[model samples]
Target: MRLLVMLTCLLAGCLAEKPHPCESPPLLTGALTVSTQNEKLWTYTRFMYDALGQRIRLMELGTYENKSFSHDVLALFREATMYEISYHNRTCKKKPLKTDFQPLAIPKDATLLGQAVLGSSSGPGQGLLVNTWTGDLPGKAGKYMNTVTEFGCIPIATSYQTSEFGWAVTSFFNNVIGIEDPGLLNPPDFCPDAEMMDSKVEPIDFLSLFHGKA
Candidate 1:
């Protein structure tokens, strides 16, 4: 279950947009692509955000050996809650999950790779930032090399390679930011057994994000 949470966070984080002040709001929606060296393992993701810069929805659809599965996540940041509905073997179970919606800080050891224009389906911008770092991934032994890219202070891409794994995983965010539909913020009725999971994460000041240049 925690693995699923981390996956969603990494996928969604790669597409995170600069946090906006409460007075001025914006919405973001886009598809996320996750791929690895071995073609057999991959995922297709879609995520949505509300005006407050909170992630409202994230869905991951995957196909393996001609079979498919999905993970649907719905979040209520104001209520400090998260829901995860997972599908496997044609069955789905909804569980309460824990998370901090606040932006994750870049590790101090990460080396800035200089800023440049990152052109992609997510749009081209001159201020896109990139950094390289080495760190231990969750639930994985040893350290890995990671490269992170950001636009408007929000991460737009992340890639990592580890010697032990013999493969690299890369995630990309397709830029699609605009006004979001209010109805999409609500959780789907299909997931009825959502329960809260215990966690000790703390929230950060969202407005202060992007204060310094990358």
Candidate 2:
């Protein structure tokens, strides 16, 4: 009947979900757990990100080839320099930072995969809504899939796979909206005495460092 068809159309419209575009906060501090394909590498990283300022600091503790190590890295994109400090060895290495600053925002060309609730939705404040997106990396170097909160655009998890390197997944947690101390981005005092590497040498990719490349 015509009346039945009309009600079905109304119900379909009400059930359809609309996707919204979102960008993460310009500044944030978070903890990340990164793992590569086949459990080849694993790392726990604490990071302070300043997307607007084109800078980031990371303290990474990782296990690779059954060896555990810890290090700190400060990447200054504007200055095109990166400082890697090894607390255990009391050593520092300064090298060029060749990669451009990739913002935390979702790419405009990203495709929305779907929306889901992270927890029980039986009652108010019971669940967290999130959206998943997928897109190509810059220069078509790789592909990435990421998930973020539906409300504040806080990142939940991201995965990347490239031709040169295998896939890696990073899960974000304990994310705070803003940096409590800007000084955290500054290189340590010992960085001034760091061994300066040749600028012409091939430099490590800033983002790849967390992927167990370093």
Candidate 3:
């Protein structure tokens, strides 16, 4: 177990198997384009600010194939983006510690994506409606086609100083590209690492994240 943790500290720019799942919901506040061999989907989850590093509003639009799915404003997260996350070390089982949110940064295509919802519909009450009929169909309802939809889609610990922990994190953060591993079939070590070195986000400039909040 100790050996496993040591390996993670030594390796970066790739994935490593983390024992634990995401302890908290992802702090999503930007645009995400998810594509597979079958189809492509673009999602724009609108985000508003509560404070410097906190979020207040929430809204989203997902487009799969040609149909569109708009999401309702459900909940808000305060300082999750800025708060440090400490849980079971996913890469190494023996290590127990907390890591801060990689200071949010601006996405590369910030200007094009963050500007508006692309390929989206402007329909009213455009979100989903949950209507289940056991034996009868509701009065004011129309039939719809298509039920199945295609999918998606992090990182990781980063210490301020290398000496802060057993391993040093000269830089710790993730980019929106290539952040998934399927298990032993595809270990984190095999997956590529986070991209914050050539990134434009500063360690403390949280609002700048509003640009690449994905």
lDDT of 3: 0.28
Model 3 C-alpha lDDT per residue in residues 1-214, reported as the tens digit of each score:
9998988777852564422211122343333322222333444544432223333332345555557765422111332223211123332111111223332332222221111222343775453221111111123232211111111112222212111122222111222332132121121341133222322434433221222222
How accurate locally is residue 120 in candidate 1, as Cα lDDT from 0 to 100? 44
Clashing pairs in 1: 122-175
Error of 2 at 186 (Å): 1.1
> Which candidate should be chosen as best, given TM-score against the real structure?
2
RMSD of 1: 15.9
lDDT of each: 0.50, 0.83, 0.28
For candidate 1, give the lDDT of residue 28.
63
Candidate 1 residue runs with Cα over 4 Å from true position: 1-27, 37-40, 50-56, 64-66, 75-92, 98-105, 115-151, 161-168, 189-214
Ranking by TM-score: 2, 1, 3
Question: Please, what are the lDDT tens digits per residue for candidate 1 over residues 64-178?
Answer: 4345656565666666555554444323333333345633335544444444454444655435555444555545644444444543334455555544224545454674656
Model 3 ranges with Cα > 4 A deviation: 1-40, 50-53, 65-67, 78-103, 106-214
